[model samples]
Target: MSKVWMRTRGWVRRARPLVSLALVLAVLAACAPGPGSERADIKIGVQGPITGQWALEGLGFRNAVALLADEVNAQGGPLGDGRSIVLVEGDDRGDADEARRVAERLIAEGVIAVVGAYNSDATAASAPLYDEAGIIQITPSSTATDLTQHGYSRFFRVCYLDDRQGLFVASLMATELHVKRAALVHDGSLYARGLADWTQRYLQEQGIEVVYFGAVTPGQRDFTPVIQALDESGAEAVYFTAYWREAGLLVRQMREMGVDDVRFLAGDAVNNPEFAQIAGAEAAAGSLISTFPLPRDLQSPEAVAFSSAYEARYGEAPQSIYTLMAADGFRLLVDAMKETGSVDPADLAAHLHAIQDYPGISGPIEGYDEKGDRIGAGHVVYVVTEEGDFELFKP
Candidate 1:
């Protein structure tokens, strides 16, 4: 099914009473105290691919938002700013168009800022709407180099960008893992292609030859040819710059083809519990993947408390350590509102830009200049081990 069709059908099947309830709530929501409806607390919108291949990312973000909302409310709500804070949640279903539409709707609803749209393509599509509306966006997982290019002005990211992450992986392959020969395989999608190109250039610069650069489609059933090509090339490592679905197939196919020596490595897009679930525990057992650090020694008191509260409230463990980053992003906007003493979009943006070394849950996120690149080149790298799952590989 098409992305639109599937999204439409999914909503339609649940729309009957739910849609009516939504409409009624919208009408009744006029009395609610929010920046959009009132001059009080701001409405922070959160969006992500909640039900698609990258659902884990969205689920983690949603849980963090909910946790933060509760904590903020307990502290007398959304910085008060003379009013109450409200969270307006939306789903983008992993489609760029859906992400764009949802962002527009949130802006129309008067949100001061937005939290996510996990992948780069979705973030790239949704950011302009927030920019045109003069609302800020702090994505926990959008890593495309161009998402903030042209200074979307209103756009910000919690994670490192393409160059830092891609090059970090290249260095890991060259110096740490002893990987001399590699194949850069991607999903043929925007995020995959960008990361692949960056990693390829960096790998070559490090004197490591890329034996093959392969392309595969999302949801492609079998990866026999792709795996066969890598096996034939005798590459020691296969670097997959795609999401989990294709990564699962490629890893399994490599194992089935009797290519056990070829180590499979992936980027953050494929780093999740679901990868092991779909890719099978044994096939995924010895794989190597890169992701954010564990942050077990968080310096911020709020971050430490939030971690405990999250585990207690959710029961299940949180994926996406970026979970805490999303909450901190929301808090930063509210803090900006308080610091500026006005909800004027420009004033809020100014405050965010002036921020320095603000400790957040995922770590510290420093605001950017017109270029939107992180000032500090401090991206930590990881490796998936048979025993440790994914442990910090490079600092």
Candidate 2:
């Protein structure tokens, strides 16, 4: 062997044990959880209807949060110091009392933040609890007009407000659908009343005749009475401002009562697969809905990637807009946490208010206004196809 070869061999022999020791130590480090790992796992409460009619939306939010937790933690989570997310599930069952209970429980659990209450009525019911506790509560859905009106600094929502949705629907009715005479029906709930009232005002302002205005006791089995009123009033269209469960029943009842020629329009709450499930694909066809941005309308690369990842992880496509908004809500919280380097709701609230043009999978949030309403948030128009899926309305 040459002199150079002999020297190289000696160096390799001397370094071998040290290199082996380093490899063993690295493996041990990888196997053992780090010292700060336990402290770093931040607990966030996720509240929604896990067992009621709106359970699908709640479950979707849970799945989206789980997916995001996994993804964020893989990159070292919000703090980027080996921190991770730990979600505490709160099932509100879509009831006001249950929602209040859930909110109180989450606050008692010492969670840093909360995401929940898919329906606006439930959200409004629970908002006081979170606000009193000073816990940052970001809802993935819930679009009642007055959600942000109470001036709760910790309360925020990713979806557009009911006023925007109602306005858009009224415009669609006047200019596109050319609705002249209509009937308005709403469940006697805060959400339904606010949305329906706004739409009714806008419709009348546009010179559309509101032939019948009525309210229904939600969870009632029969909507035939309301359908008969619409028929008698000779309404060219019927607008229902409520959740899918009631909307589905009302639509089906209207069809059953031979109110076929009158077009049906609804709000964001009906933008779910359960709507079709309850109304039947045949019954749901040709209904127009006002809602947040649909997955098909998302053109951002982040949105496209998120949709693909969500499908791959869940083994199915997302059926509700809440899933995307839930993910965005979580992202917004985490981003605030990172920016402020604190889990304090007050700090999160400040950061949230300051965020501008946050690129989210749902859509870019232009930040919160003085009342905490998301600036630049708007609604889209969709029509249910024969197959009972929402597609962008051409008209």
Candidate 3:
């Protein structure tokens, strides 16, 4: 054999064993489980506006869910099985059409559960999709009463229904404000219309006359016609059942239009920091908002801890009560998962329904009724201070 040929043969012979050993090691490594390999990731969907006029509330929902996810993961996940929670975010832009698309996307992504679609319209649109897909949905702020009437066993909300809020508003107007005549206005959205209708019913029950029950196109800036209507109606109080932006604009316009004698009351949707900014401190001051307890007003240990954590992470306190409610929804889901030890939609739903007096960051959740409506949920009226802060209404 040639000298070069012999050298090549020797080299091949020497490398053969090394190559075989490398192959064996690679096979062993491939077969063996690595760190976190035994644990699977649990996917949860966080759906909301995220980028529209209600982006503040949507962003709060996302942030609160993310924070809760981080905390749960740090604690060895929901079942303490080393499985980590993976959050999938779907932004519906606070529109029903977009919410339908988001719902499909989240279902396709294989999310076991969802928390959001902050607007009632969005929630109503996406709820059917979730139900059909066997996914659990928990809304933090969608308060339309009809949502629970759909017979969707997997759907629930951490917040009270619009009917409850409406009753509270009507009682506040009758007992505290002593208004004999009220004007009702809505933004033509599901939440706004539902709240307005219920409020009108309760107000009439209280022997208060509803002089004007009207709808305003959402996102409209000028309210000259509505202000004129309010003036003509001779309403002692104006109850606005809509979001903060519209309520703020309407209130500001009313004050500027010399409609000063009318008391401006808003629904839970108006409990936002930007309300005062939009309406101006002078106009927003003394305005009553019927809503769940504000985060600043909550004094429970769980609430205090959540608020501190949220502030520390976000560099500011929660701007809306919905933020805390969003956190509560996430916690409720996790608690159900931990208690049931299963991610199956049916198990989670059943466990949620069975939950009683569950301590939540917002308050004690006294379980869900057969319709998935939150039981023992209550509302309180808050007055806007001159500094644009929400304080409990003593009167």
Candidate with top TM-score is: 3
- Which residue pairs show backbone clashes in model 1? 40-83, 41-83, 41-84
Model 3 off-target regions past 4 Å? 1-39
The per-model lDDT (C-alpha) reads: 0.75, 0.82, 0.87
| TM-score comparison, 2 vs 3, better candidate | 3
Best by lDDT: 3
User: Residue by residue across 1-395, what tens digits does model 2's lDDT show?
Assistant: 11111110111223456568788667655545332234545778889988877788998888888888777778887888776677878899889988988888777666778888788878999998888888888998888888888879888888888887777878888998898998888998888999999999889988998999998887887988888888999999988888888888888888888789999988888777678778988999999888886776797987888888889988886767788899899999998988888877798899998899899888888888866778875688788999988788887
In model 1, the runs with Cα more than 4 Å from the true position are 1-41, 295-300
**lDDT score, candidate 2, position 138:** 91
lDDT-wise, the better of 1 and 3 is 3
* Cα lDDT for residue 341, candidate 2: 89
List residue ranges in candidate 2 displaced over 4 A.
Answer: 1-40
Ranking by TM-score: 3, 2, 1
What is candidate 3's lDDT per residue for 1-395, written digit by digit as tens? 11111110111223355568788667666645332244446778989988978899899998888888888988988999887788888999999999999999988777889999799999999999999999999999999998988799999999999888888888888887899999999988899999999999999999999999998998899999999999999999999998889889999998998899999999888888889999999999989988888888899999999999999988998878889999999999899888888878799999998889999998989889988899975898889999888888897
TM-score of 1: 0.85
Ranking by lDDT: 3, 2, 1
Per-candidate clash tally: 3, 0, 0
Residue range with the least summed lDDT across 10 consecutive positions in model 1: 1-10
